[model samples]
Target: MSNMVKIAMTSDLSPGTGTTIEMEDQSIALFNVEGNFYAIADTCTHRGGSLGEGRLNGDIVTCPKHGAHFNVKTGEVTFPPARFGVKTFPVTIEGDDVLITLD
Candidate 1:
């Protein structure tokens, strides 16, 4: 396994919001639920939309383009037209920093 990268501070992300970070030529989306952090592919599985720009409701994130919903915690597709699931990264919180492992 590779080392986890410190993408952002835990305080950097607010609840029900997400931030985008670029790593290894891939865009990853980091979300904050209360104090917990979740990371997922920034690209939506359907229509190539940006997941970071989507809205978050509980653990589900709805794609801005086509209304595709995904569970940020598990990367599961909750609604269509997103039949495929996006990638999710492992996230850890160290003090005020949020760390994630990239593919």
Candidate 2:
């Protein structure tokens, strides 16, 4: 078992929505997709676009800056502009709190 951090409450995030939170000086983006939660690096790999501000279409999120697409579930690059994929963290939901594992 690794160290985990509580990022948000279940009530704070609705389905198909996302929020940004700070973790170890880095911004992490948390998304709620049909009751399941996902977390990834908030900045886009291409030009440092904020993934939290990007548009969410199903499990994929399009970067608002360079139009790059990433899967919230896997943090894989689905579209161009970014040749790399973002880092994904494991998420856990306890009661109404949402937790993310960084280790």
lDDT of 2 by residue, 26-94 (tens): 799999999899999999999999999899889999999989999999999999999999999999999
Give the Å shift of residue 68 in candidate 2.
0.2
TM values, all candidates? 0.95, 0.96
TM match of model 2 to true structure: 0.96
Q: In candidate 1, which residue ranges exceed 4 Å CA deviation?
A: none
Looking at model 1, residue 26 earns an lDDT score of: 83
State each candidate's clash count: 0, 0
Clashes of 2: 0
In the predicted model 1, the residue pairs found to clash are none
Candidate 1 yields a Cα-based lDDT of 0.89
- The top-ranked prediction according to lDDT is 2
